[model samples]
Target: MDLSELLDDLIRFWPVDVDDVSLIGHSMGGLVLRSAGHHGYEAAHEWTGKAKTYVSLGTPHSGAPLENLAHQASAILAARPETNAFGRLLRRRSGGIRDLRAGSLVDSDWQGRDPDGLAAAMAAEVPLLPGVDHYWVSATLTRDPKHPLSRVIGDGLVLHHSAGGRNSTRHIGFTEDNGLHLGRANHFNLLNDARIAAKLVDWVG
Candidate 1:
């Protein structure tokens, strides 16, 4: 909501008549941007329509398995009275963390559900803007995406397929040419990689 409001303010007060803009998001930031694009304030359509390109860097578009595991762990810990405090802290994650379970992009995706329980099924899909170009970048700590380690510990958090928006169940409609896989790169490094910066410039140019 804050981000949506900020974007609305920026568009309303910007000096120039910004017809187009490029959005580059990293990690959870990407999901927030997607949510804003899907359902923001009244003026959201006006500003979001100006997005010529949307780039996601190491975003868990299909949800993070690691967070699921943490959710389970927290549940177990909460069951024991001795460590209940720590478990409570973990269970009380921000909405952003809870939304990561299924990479939620709208309020309807999670509203009225128990945040600590299993991820709620999305009631409706959030489609991208018709004219906007969506791009994704994924990082892998291993040299080969096929490696067992890479599959389990992708970028130490997100799976390669999830970050690249290649899940078989969901179709975000990103083109093959728009997805890039960076070898030996961790999730955080995706934000600072020169290659990623170059690709963003090229794509958004």
Candidate 2:
């Protein structure tokens, strides 16, 4: 649906003769980029063939733990009449916010699932583009990435592991070599920090 619409718009408006296509997105935008690429690849869209490099900055590919917590909290509140209103309000978060719960990038990932349910099964894995080089940048608030807090509350929002697209169920095919991890930084730092800019230069400049 939405992904298909994006793919169609991309095909319609983009130049046709570009030889190499490099894509970069931050936060939820990264997931959108992946969805677009995946959608194009699945449908044999011509642009998919020109895609060469993709980079995601602070994307919660494995899902955002904060959203999961909020979902759980909403359920608890909904169980009591005293807090039902609050629960309903929380559940009213936009679809884009809900999609962050599992980094869902395609229709099958959420089509038939109960919107209020927080089941792990709702997080279906979407395959990566076959020939595209995918890269990721993740950060943590602590000076040391190995700090216990970094692992649990990375960048104050997304977990370090999730940003890197790794979870107990699967690794989203990113290699250590293709990822960049920054410490003593928050999620937004991935957007314009000098280190990140340098890395981008090395990777695609």
Candidate 3:
């Protein structure tokens, strides 16, 4: 089963084992956790369990547009044979598992979705859980200082929409201001970046 489904099961039978559970997911993990909430929010609250905090690091809560542009099969075939699970998984979905592969690519219009679309469901639903604290952490480089939004110097993977959540506790703006941005680490580097690791230690503890 997927992580999202596991989250659903846990939320349903939470009181059986634990008191309250706080889920921590990075990048797409955050989306899976969020999807868990979007689908299971109603059943979750009645249990003695509670979702304490949600922390997302450059999470494409709205789905990664870059994935759509790259075509998972191409990216996977280009990668080595061993760690290309993502590429294989993409092929499976693109083949027929998904309803409409072409129409599902991310775009500005995705922001307008109501109950059905990803972005809308996440923004509207995930925060509804009682006692849930959300955190949106994003990475960036030096502000170009020319174009308005370009000044942010994002990691080039997570765009603004993917990082935003209404109930977030920390809108960490990493750069030269507080600390230095790591030269490495893209959107997928949830385990990289000493600075980010430090932040997580502080947040979860």
**What are the models' TM-scores?**
0.90, 0.92, 0.52
Better of 1 and 3 by lDDT: 1
Worst 10 residues of 1 by lDDT: 117-126
> Tens digits of per-residue lDDT for model 3 on 153-175?
34566554345531233232222
User: What does candidate 1's lDDT look like per residue over 1-205, in tens digits?
Assistant: 5676677679878998987877789988888887777765334456776768888998888888877787887888888999999889888787778777778877776667766765543534667756789999888899887789999889988889888765668867777788999889899998688998788778998
For model 2, residues 1-205, the per-residue Cα lDDT tens digits are 4664565567668766566778899999998889888777778776678778899999999889888888898988988999999999899988888889888887677787888986664666788888888899999999877799898899988888887888888788888899998989998878789998999998887
Candidate 3 TM-score over all chains jointly: 0.52
Cα RMSD of predicted structure 3: 9.4
List residue ranges in candidate 2 displaced over 4 A: 1-16
True-structure lDDT of candidate 1: 0.79
Off by over 4 Å in 3: 1-17, 45-48, 68-128, 141-153, 166-185
Decreasing lDDT order of the candidates: 2, 1, 3
Candidate 3 — what's its lDDT? 0.47
lDDT of 2 at 154: 93
List per-candidate RMSD values in Å: 2.1, 1.9, 9.4
